[model samples]
Target chain A: MNNMRVLAEEEETSDGVEVTWEDQQQINTFAKLNARLKGIEDKLEQLKQEKEALDDLSTELELTDEDQTVLYKLGESFLHLPQPDALVRLEIDQASVSSQLAKLGAVAEECERGMKDLKVRLYAKFGKAINLDE
Target chain B: MVEQKFPESLDKNPRGIPKAPFIANVEEYIGGPDGDVEGPLKDFQDAIAKYRYMDGSLTQRRKGLEDKIPDIRKTLQMVEFLKQRRDRKQKADDQEDDLEEDDENSEGAKKPLTTTFELNDTLFAEAQLDDTDTVYLWLGANVMLSYEIPEAITLLRSKLDAAETSLKTAIEDLEFVREQLTVMEVNTARMYNWDVKRRRERRSAEEAAKREKES
Candidate 1:
């Protein structure tokens, strides 16, 4: 017979319970395919979680223009203020806000690139498997 | 005689690193011929000292800064900023270290199911099937395959993890950007809405007409 099992739990007790090559191949192939399906499912879950986290981050980013406007106006008002104490404080505060916004803008661009890359990858890999959520 | 050895980073490949003679003519002349051969050993003493100081622990200094965060974290916003800042810093350091090791042998090694020849004990132990009797040409258990299967699974899990984190982080970043842009966009639309612009233009025209009426 061209069929055999290298070893099996059931066969430890029972003798000559031969497994065919065809059966072994079938089993191996099935195992591999099952593993592949599982991988896809896991990836899908990960992407979903990623989407959630992105949503949370976006909330932090929602106020750029208003933030800038408030900051710039404060700076302008500080220059006009006669009191040196208040003027210096407001000027420093304005500078800090501008710097923070600049940093935030940089981080925002990075996030956009990452999201775009993920979208492209998902489209390429899972276009057939899942629907892209708006 | 003390021989000069190469740095650890220089010894990656199979071939041995070439050792160079230490040139210390001034010390060599005073130490005699035999002592000249070993003259560089003193230089090594200096190397060791330099290494200790240059790459020595910043633990004390860093600890002081880290110590302050906990006290600051009593407030809500500060705590959130600290957590985010810490995570980013840790990841950045990990990336720098990974780059030194090159892409293949770094964190990428533990990545999803595709296997290469390197032996990793954790994956090996997890993947191995229980070996049954017989040392040679064993007819029963497929030990080789069972081992491969489990390791592959472990690798796959790591890969999936990386993919998941990246996707989530990206989305968070994009959402922030869009919302930020929209805030300005919303303000612009409010100030320049079609109805408002039209009304402003009409008001201007009416003011001019009133001036003509007055004349």
Candidate 2:
């Protein structure tokens, strides 16, 4: 029990929660992060017990109603957690590509303006509408 | 009806739960005989039963108090994180503006030209707050702290709506929990009182003193 207590990051909260979807998410996220950190939180102790649980089948062991719930929770936790390293690398590459595309767009606009300026300079000096299009 | 979302329903799983003993303990604790008592439960069923009236009163107060603390602490967390984010973002934004102004000049000694572009503060404020803030905050992003104030204001309006549901449900659940704790305290006090009463009646003053405890 002491080891479990040591593992959990004890929050010095004195009150129970005021239930809300937002609040529920906060609590669950806390739990999931705790799972990653192996936080010796009060709930994790409860979870550890479930992990090693026996015949009740209603918890984390096998397929029971509760087991269904825990697995789903684990899935949700994983889903919300940041993407895997490979996926994150891919995302970074995509972002770099997009930023370069934007830079290209800005360069294109600047070139268009520069071309217009050059066209006026040529017309001013040559004093003729040369068929630049040809 | 407002959506009733409990921890069990949080993750949408169609599979199963484990048969852990701790889970059973938690379940039993929440669903015990005197555990569900509400509204300052009678002293006889409480842990504070050693005290008949006045001491039982203190025990009840303590239980009622324990309920608001978590909410208060959470609210405090929301506030502190927001303040920190707001400061950091504001400083960074100010620095960026200065840097942009510097870029507009080739020579550092040249007088900075004032631009006619006036930024609308309201636009900036609105842009900071949106639905994604909550998820960001939940994911523990410190940057979302910058969105705290505006989100709080915007969330307040919707909260009035969601509050009707969340608060009602929260209040109901709070009341239920309060009752359970209150009864436990009171029962404890009452049992102490009964023991003391027996000792006093039997002229065993020392035993009475042993049983005499604060609720």
Candidate 3:
């Protein structure tokens, strides 16, 4: 077990690609960038879903009377609505939702731009012959 | 449904992975005489190269798993949030009913009061959350699956578990490779020592033989 621990520590110490293997280092970096790109893509997908869901829910809620009682979960618990005025829990505000959607769109655009830059760097390192599509 | 336009930069590697070089014989280099340690020397270099490659691959795999685990954990957190919201709503409903009973004689109690959400919070997107019994799970590589709330939770839990297990396995494999490299290092050192000693012995023997001939 002690030997294995030492081995494990040694492995951890050399976890990064060695500088001697220039090609391998480049390839490993490409992999890391690829993973990060995937993560950003996932976030973009999620934000799109959230915006869509919010739009659908807002349209559905607007068709009803403003004072109509609805279940609103605020914080940890749901608050009861006796009057039509105080919608303390519902997230049905139009301006706020629109801003959120716009913000997400901008973020997605930024991520795409970053990905493009990363690809350019990768191509520069591996050259045109290196197939990034594989 | 919104159509997804995947970024072009996220495309796959074009050239694919290059193949690693193979070493034919490693053991033949060991336990050889002095001055003929070139085979063992080559073997030592090959072993170091192989170890580096293995370590590099394992490192990448471990990093991938690490990234995946946190994302799955975030999914789990969302699931827990939904569950808590539902439970809170149920509790509130029970309390409202109890209040209605106490104010049975009042005109305000004529209609059962229902609470709906309406907010303009900066931290969260403002949108009415109708009770949902389902959630969408991202299954990686641009794949998303819709599952019932309970099912989504179960799936994420399993995914997190699987990712953790894979990470553990990769670490173990890396350690094993490191151990092999260490053994190779020891063997090379011992072989060099043996070669040096043999050369000294041979030089002394040659001197004794020449001296006897001169006598």
Instruction: Name the candidate that leads on lDDT.
Output: 3
Give the number of colliding residue pairs in candidate 3: 21
Which DockQ values do the candidates obtain, in the order shown? 0.01, 0.01, 0.09
TM-score of chain B of each: 0.26, 0.27, 0.65
Candidate number achieving the greatest TM-score relative to the actual structure:
3
Interface RMSD of 3: 12.2
lDDT of 2 at A89: 29
Off by over 4 Å in 1: A1-134, B1-147, B194-202, B205-211
Query: Across residues A18-96, which tens digit of lDDT does each residue of candidate 3 receive?
Result: 2223443444444444544564576557666766776676566667676455544433234454333223223544454
TM-score of each: 0.19, 0.21, 0.45
What clash count goes with each model? 8, 47, 21
Looking at candidate 2 chain B, the ten consecutive residues that score lowest on lDDT are B13-22
lDDT of each: 0.36, 0.35, 0.56
Best DockQ among the predictions, by candidate number: 3
CAPRI tier of model 3: incorrect
